[model samples]
Target chain A: DTAVSQTPKYLVTQMGNDKSIKCEQNLGHDTMYWYKQDSKKFLKIMFSYNNKELIINETVPNRFSPKSPDKAHLNLHINSLELGDSAVYFCASSQDLDGADTQYFGPGTRLTVL
Target chain B: DQQVKQNSPSLSVQEGRISILNCDYTNSMFDYFLWYKKYPAEGPTFLISISSIKDKNEDGRFTVFLNKSAKHLSLHIVPSQPGDSAVYFCAASGFFQGAQKLVFGQGTRLTINP
Candidate 1:
């Protein structure tokens, strides 16, 4: 079975629009994270949640928000998407925040803002 | 400024040859180092990792070496195959994970020619 999966593999929207990307995992992991991969192929952590509680909130804009209804699901919502938000968004899960715990990632969602 | 850097944007290697990828970081607090592999249109998958206490760790054909003094790391793959063609990302984490974050390099695309 796929460990992690994300919906709307390809999202095309206009600037100032609202959009949401849904992520789910069945690996029984305790932590989930959202990452942004820019055009330069640099992946940066935007947010992290452990057991449905927000843990890591990097220097992301307030327009972006992460919500985890349960340990298996973490969704990303953008209040007003901008052209700069066009990038590949990835969802990941780990057993814990421990160094030994490796993360399992999804196929990723490519968001394009026009 | 980028804390983690992968100087080489891409590398080409022949099948059955050895492929070496390098990574450097500017942070001294990073104790856990990891490598992930990714294909186009997909998220990165965890490959291997090393902790500060140890200088080297190996799994099958993959080996990771860490040099704390130089803040450098390398991933070596022996007998590289065509299936091994993908982008490799280097990542490091500082603090107790829960209290900190994981910094990632841009990525190095490796093309294995058969």
Candidate 2:
């Protein structure tokens, strides 16, 4: 079974369009995170939810929002996407928020905003 | 500011040779460090990790070394195979805003030549 899975592996949308990417983890983890990797391969944490509670929120723009319906799922929604939003979005999950815990990542969703 | 930095953008190594990737961090509070490997069109997978209290940790052909005094870490893959070619990312986690969040460095592309 895929430990982590993401929907719409590839997404291409125009500017000002809104889209949502869904993520699911079968690892039964409690902490889920969203990350963004840019063209230069610089990975940055966008948001994190532990047991459906927001734990970490990086300085991302307001247009980007994360929703965790449950411990096993987390979804990212973008509003009025801009060119800068074109990047790969990754969903990751860990057993908990322990700093030493290992995080399992799903196949990334490549988002292109033209 | 990039707290964690991987100065080398790319490293080429012959198959069956040792591949070493280096990372440096400016945050003294970072207590847990991890290495992740990512292939084309996939999210990063956790490779190895080391805590601040330990100087080294090894798993099979992969090993991680941490030097707290220098705030530096390195991942060594011995007998690297062609399949090992991918982007390696170094990440660190510490208490931030009442929770632990990971900070990833710019990835290093490792090419294992057969």
Candidate 3:
């Protein structure tokens, strides 16, 4: 079974457009995270939610927002997307907030902002 | 500043040989370390991990070594097979903004040849 899944494997939109990526996990995890892999292949965490409560919010731009309606779902919405936003976005989930817990990641969504 | 770093961008190993991947970190607060493997068009999967208290962890043919004094870690794969060819990422876990967060390296692509 796919423990973590993401919608729209690829997204291409013009500049200033808005887009949303949906993620879901069936591992019954309590924490979900959003990460971005830039052109340099640096994977950085953007936000994290635990039990539908915002827990970790990195120094990301305000244009990006993460929403977790439940423990199993976490979505990322970007407004006024720019060319710099072209990268791969990944969704991950873990059992809890423990540092030793292993996190499972989704296939990732490649976003191209033209 | 990048807390976790994988200096090697790629490594090649002959089939049935051992493959060693190295990683270093600058953050002393990181108590947990993990290695993840990713194939093209797929998400990263957990491979092995080691905690700060332990110097080595072994799982089958894969072993992880942690040196807390040097803030370094390594993953060794014995008798690596062709299927082991993938991108390997090193991650460090620590508290950030009052929540446990994982910081990942740029990844090192491993190519196993027969």
Tell the DockQ for candidate 1: 0.76
Predictions ranked by lDDT, top down? 3, 2, 1
Cα lDDT tens digits for candidate 1, A49-111: 999999899879999999999999999999889999999999999998875689889999999
| Backbone N/Cα/C clashes per model | 0, 0, 0
Error of 3 at A65 (Å): 0.9
Where does the lowest 10-residue lDDT sum fall in candidate 2 chain A? A36-45
lDDT of 3 at B70: 92
> Which lDDT value does model 2 have at B1?
91
lDDT of 3 at A65: 93
- What are the per-residue Cα lDDT tens digits for candidate 2 across B1-114? 999999999999999999999999999999899999999988899999998999999999999999998999999999999999999999999998888989999999999999
Chain A TM-score values for every predicted structure, listed in order: 0.98, 0.98, 0.98
lDDT for each residue of candidate 1 in B75-106, tens digit (9 for 90 to 100)? 99998999889999999988744465788999
> In candidate 2, what are the lDDT values of residues A50-91, reduced to their tens digit?
999998889899998899988999999999999999999999
Ranking by DockQ: 3, 2, 1
Q: Which residue pairs of candidate 3 clash? A: none
lDDT of 3 by residue, B1-114 (tens): 899999999999999999999999999999899999999999999999998999999999999999999999999999899999999999999986688999999999999999
Q: Could you tell me the interface RMSD of model 3?
A: 0.5
Cα deviation of B23 in candidate 3 (Å)?
0.1
